[model samples]
Target: MDDIRLLPATGLEGLIAQLRSRGYRVMGPTLRDDAIVTGEIRSASDLPQGVGDEQDPARYRLRKRDDGAYFGFAAPAQSSKPVFFPAEEVIWRGRRDTAVTPDSAASASTPDNAGNPTTAPASSPHDPGFTVERDQLDAPPIALLGVRSCDLRAVQIHDKVLAGRTYIDAHYVTRREATFVVAVACSDPAATCFCASMGTGPRPAATDPATGEPSYDLLLTEIAPSDPDRHHFVLEIGTEAGRDVAHAIDTAPAEFDDQHEALAVTAHAASQQTRRITAATVRDDLRASAESSRWEDVASRCLSCTNCTLVCPTCFCTTVEDVSDLTGATAERHRVWDSCFSEDFTYIHGGPTRESVKARYRQWITHKLSSWEDQFGMLGCVGCGRCIAWCPAGIDITEEAAALGRMRAGGVLPTGDHVPTGDHVTVTS
Candidate 1:
């Protein structure tokens, strides 16, 4: 099979069938509860065809499209994180068992040890013993269809955070390794998208380091119809497995015109996006603007609801909990996704360290934009703008970063008559 091929829009059903025949549980975009979301998709008809989304600060709505194109929506309400790194998972389970032991008198009365028999006290049950077992995974191979570019980058970030050097999450590794990706280049970006500035997407660009191949097994770029009512996709095979699947379907080699139209699709999507941020310099500027008054202004509007962190694909904080049965014979431990916005998240010996909303808000954004680079060697945000559209108060991260930059250039500190002293900030009367 050629590396690049043109697949008619109808060919998508064949693609799904091929994956299922290979023992993959195919998941893709579908309309659920009035939103486009990922779910088990058996065929192209199961996808959210001819549907688009409208997104703005504190707003999201589903709209109709005249072009009957699948993969027409931007980022879904949920990212791929829930599939690999589950929101809640049981790590281990334990069971208690009882055993019997002979009393001292009973031992002395044994045939070999006792001369004359005194009535021996009945044997008693000894201390109960417990056995623990770690949860072992046996999930089926998963083929994720219709992944967007921003989300592809988000998955890469999750790999670094969960399966990196010092610590590795075994469950995440197991699921991630067993999954196959089918990424789609964005042709209809939402108003909230800023991946153009972040360099994460409108197009599929991630490459797997281990295999030196595109991160997706199969990448798709949908070109708008040249003919009034026809649509097709430019499919790029990125792995041997993808090539095998392509062989199962009838595809023609992509021509120069097909490739050109595909490029135009992604380019037009990038140009249509209204949001912007300088991803390269935001880290350094955020590190220096910790003392900026902008934190207070943002906090006043922030409910500390943790919506941003929950929607954020790169956020990895979690908490563990233990459960026991009524008889205390069975026990289980679970790891649940947690948020930095929770006051209890920062609880220390005294109390919650970040008691004020101001301090918590400062920590959340600073860690995401600045200190994340210090820890992970990359900024935490993928610029998907889920945080912006989902926030009830309409607080925008890009806007906050820009405000901080503007304040820094003016040499005006947030507090009155104050100036930064070398590496420290000082206040004056």
Candidate 2:
């Protein structure tokens, strides 16, 4: 690891300008209408500075903070995947036309006289022409600012699935490969986050250096108790590109050994506030409980709107369709996002594999918590709790999982099995 650099607040604007000048699109959190949204940002002024977000199930709002702290909040309502595999995309186009025949006179003139050894010229014949072309898209190099650590880890997991040896997603790789991640240490985490239990969290330990195989280029940690006039960022470079980008900013060398380590500990401690599920039995339990009564209870309140899958950072299922204009001359095939919660998602030649709402809900949860490990070598969920926080009915996944565990354990569920003890954790902000 390189020495930390002290960057003043104004240095942020310079960094944005540098990125834009290098032909890279700068995407970061910004205050939109009433919430923080990720989009193209041209300068530092575009950031959601001094603002915090209040997120709950089916709702998200922005609130003013006393301190003008930038990047001081939890995950946003939307994930960053849409930037790559968009919600909708055109896959192909087709046109229909009839074939044309050659002129009769010309054909007659092309007849050969075998006896006389004389042959006439061949006539030209027109045939139907159908052309198929793939859509050409280039993934521009992106500089992502203020990315939370959990989402950063999510990106890593996505790379493993999308760019793994077995199958490489051409679309995802084309757009996500060359991204420049500027990870922001979480100064404030939501009550719903359980990254600590997962061994990934608000702050990553410097001792466990990010593996260069798939590591962030730059990492930024905000020094707390910052005032409007005096703010500091502990910047560390992880790659050659990161070094180059850091050099562009007017900064001074600073020692962050103590502060950075303390922050990492604080972040880890904060993660304990979340309920922990024993991953040991999660897989077997999910497979065994596929037809359990707990699913029926969950499905009763589920609206089948598919909000959970949509907000999830890892769900990547999609569907395609073909549409033609009213004139019937032009047509296009499009690929769009889909969810297992939807009734049509399980459709087959005859009908859907899972007919009841209970079955669909069972499939989704089981896949996420259990089957995913067998399929991808990692859990599908990152414990972000977006599903619980965004579900219209306020359905808590941890609560439901605990309840099912009790049913499976002969009606004797372990107390505080997944609940936060409030002893190992502490929150400063």
Tens digit of per-residue lDDT, candidate 1, span 263-288: 88899999887787788888888888
Q: Highest TM-score among the candidates is held by which one?
A: 1
How would you encode candidate 2's per-residue C-alpha lDDT over 189-264 as one tens digit per residue? 6666666665556665332223336356677777653576667677777677878888988777766573565377
Residue 422 lDDT (model 1): 28
Evaluate candidate 1 by giving its C-alpha RMSD to the native, one decimal: 7.9
Instruction: Supply every candidate's count of residue pairs whose N, Cα or C atoms clash at under 3 angstroms.
Output: 0, 1
Off by over 4 Å in 1: 99-125, 206-213, 225-229, 416-429
TM-score of each: 0.88, 0.83
Angstrom error of the Cα, residue 73, model 1: value is 1.3
